[model samples]
Target: MSHSTKNSHLSTTVANLKPSGIRRFFDLAANMDNVISLGVGEPDFVTPWNVIEASYHSLEQGYTAYTANAGMIELRQEISNYLKHRYFVDYNPDNQVIVTVGASQGIDLALRALINPGEEVIVIEPGFVSYAPAVTLAGGDPIIINTKPEHEFKLQPEQIEDAISEKTKAIILCSPNNPTGSVLTKEELIKIAAVIEKHDLIVLSDEIYAELTYDEDFTSFAFIKGMKERTILISGFSKAFAMTGWRLGYATGPREIIEAMVKIHQYTMMCAPTMAQHGALEALKNGQKSVLDMKKSYRQRRNFVVNSLKEMGLDCHLPGGAFYVFPSIKSTGLSSEEFAEQLLRKERVAVVPGNVFGSTGEGYIRCSYAASLKQLDEAMKRIKKFINEL
Candidate 1:
């Protein structure tokens, strides 16, 4: 179809939305040979055998039907218990939890439920590629806050206080952050909470990597004093449980906001997959060992990758959690995109350009340590060679 013809059928918001930069590099790598990809943020581990068996058993027991719009009560209750025990926060299973297709969907649902046209939502960078576009799609303007590398990429309280406006409705926060892998400490969160409470703004806290922290215990933003009632916590089994393909996640928050999200979910997704919900229930009940095991491996890989990048003279931070390392490519005298693309073509290594995450990321590149040590070692060698040749 011609561009004009396609534009006639597409809403301006949908048409204007930029495609995900991560996927673009993944596609380029897909068509190449012998490429070692450190681009995607997904875990390299398989789903735990127990979780898989539970899903299989659900199918055997004839549980293949659509679940309640909010999801199976048993699953929701398990999620509630897990959060309380792990994070010292509580949510009523009946009205305060909704199982989502993925944490990605939970983000979309939260924005659509809370935002009206022309309102603004604060988005920090370098952040997940989806945040700004998701806000735009939900009819909210995204007010960008660029956190500096000197601050360890953690959002500062002053940034939040300065960005507030009458049209500001909510803020999206992710930690251990995706591209940067920076986890916000409890003291830092308390400072941020002070700002949020002072402004009375709602927070959509994405804790999808909650179980993957290496250096410290993960702190739930909702657990901050006076924050639970105003924070929507979005998490899932994807990263920690290595169940990305299962497509299961959830959100817990104030009953009213969760109910509004459910209303939209019922008209759209209906419910998370019934089989996946059953699998996730098992994950919450008995998958702690698997979670810890994967966390151990990720911690090792994180150290190895960070050391490798630093050895090769790339300025890299020791990420506190998650499996990504954002290393500055500035000394190589190349833009983020040029460095990533040329490295892929010449060295057969695929890492995402940092600028795709946000403008503040322009001089850096994001490399995931989620690959095996064997693959990571080889990819690091290739990357070092690429830089040397440059």
Candidate 2:
């Protein structure tokens, strides 16, 4: 049958969903050549060589078979230990953690496990694109709480409290946040923790960039007092380990919640790729050295791009973690979407429009500094020239 013939029953869920603004802009840039994309918020670094070697060894050792729905016990233990070592959070490997396809699926699973029709999920503005759609797909209302640049794009405890209503179900947080790259201070998280405690809200904390902190040690919501029972901590090897294609990530939370998520997982994914899990297990065990090295390179790029943007008169801040800097182009009196389009057309440089993140994300553009310094230098030169023209 033709697509049009079968398209009639397209679930309203899928039918009504608008494409991600980030991906729309990215798609527009994909066909153009001589283009530099700082848009995709991905590490340009290759997965470390040793991790690849381990994957080969695992397959050669005949380790290619389905694992448990939650994933291999040994791999789970490694993830548990890795969490303890890095974040001081303790979770039982057997019950608390579930190996996911990536932090991406972990987001979907958390939503699937929690949302009911019309229940509100509070999402931080200028947040990653995934949270809203995931919540919507699970039949939840996405309540956006816009955070401003003046506030460093950090969530205020008061704001959280205000957004909550009787129908509120959860709050999804990302920091070193994408687009903006803002890290929440411990004090800020502590404040938010109190509100969640008061409201008893489920917290889905996506901390995939936790290991990329530059200014201070990254803290986990999982480690926060009273959060263990209420928070679902989603993290993955993709960002920190430069293993984006590996498609391995995991979540730790209350057993009941995880068990519920695994029910969805069993039908949706069955199991994460066995070879990828093996690689992720290796990543947890020996990935730290590689993570640190990749982080070192990224830190340099962050400083280079952020500083260059400032020298060119863009209102940008040095972000605390992650490899992106969201710089304001408001002074130019153009919408971020317009600025981004012009930058690509005139300079052939691709950066995500901040408005794509949310309404409050307007007047700024998000550029990932995950590329080589050489590419960044060329891109910066083009950007400087482009801005000068305006």
Candidate 3:
């Protein structure tokens, strides 16, 4: 079929959507040699041996078939136990949780199941790049709220209140946020919760980075008063357990919303991978030490990367969580994309342009410290050299 012929049947939403901004530099890096990449927001650690072994055991036991659309009861119960113990939140395994392909899928499912066409969802940016598009794909308009670094990237209550309109339906929030690595504090959560209560908004709380926090303990939106019934908690084993390739995640929320998402999941994804779910179950049961060990290593790398950036005269805030740092490259007289491109070209160091997250991200670049300390050291050297030359 010719291009125009193919275009005739394409959904306007999918066609007009821009490809992921992170992937643009990632693909560029793939074509280059000796490039040290700090661009991908992936854990460098392998899944723990016990988790992998459990998956192997599941396969050996002939458990490869599709799990219940909501996932295995054992797994859901385990998830329930884990959440209750870790975050002081209670969710019924039978009706309040659904295993998903990843947190990505959970986000999509939540938006798709809840959003009516032309409703608005508030998206805090520089956030995960997928948020706006996911909302748009679900037939909702996205209201972008540019969070300030000065506030450590926490969404201000005023901002939330200002963004609310008659059509506003939900707010997508990522704590221990991607790119910036800022975690919301309890006080901040209280402020946010008040606005949420007043506006009666649903919150899609992406807590994928909850375990990797360094500076403070994570507080789930569900744990706050009256918010549990209004929050969809999307998280997964990808970052915390180093199970990205396994594609396992889940969402826990009010039974009504969970049922809605599961309805969509049944017809679309059916269920998360059976093997991965089994592994995730093992992870919840036995992966605590491994998660702590990885978090320790990440904290060390975070320190090294932050110190290195300061030494090179690049301003970077000490990230409170996640394995990434957002540093200003504005002094180098380059746009985020230009700085990322030229850094890859000249120094063979791959980092993502911050503007890929939002227009407010234009003067910054996000570098993941998830790689080895040695790799980070070397990348820092190259980055310093490149900046000096500029």
* Per-model CA lDDT versus the true structure: 0.95, 0.90, 0.94
Q: Which residue pairs in model 3 clash with each other?
A: none
The estimated TM-scores of all candidates read 0.98, 0.97, 0.98
* Top lDDT hit: 1
> Candidate 3 overall Cα lDDT vs. reference?
0.94
Candidate 2: lDDT of 325? 95
Report the Cα lDDT for candidate 1: 0.95
Candidate 1 structure quality by residue, lDDT tens digits, 106-163: 9999999999999999999999989999999999999999999999899999999889
**What is candidate 2's TM-score against the reference?**
0.97
Model 2 scores a C-alpha lDDT of 0.90
Give candidate 3 misplaced runs (Cα > 4 Å): 1-7
RMSD for all candidates, in order, please.
1.3, 2.3, 1.7
| lDDT: the better of candidates 2 and 3 | 3
How are the candidates ranked when ordered by lDDT, highest leading? 1, 3, 2
- Predicted candidate 3 versus true structure: per-residue lDDT over 1-390, tens digit per residue: 233335387877777788898888889999999999998889999899999999999999999898899999999999999999999999999999999999999999999999999999999999999999999999999999999978877789999999999999999999899989989998899899999999999999999999988988999988998999999999999999999999999999999999999999999989898999999999999999999999999999999999999999988999899899999988999999899999999999999999999998989999999899999999999999999998
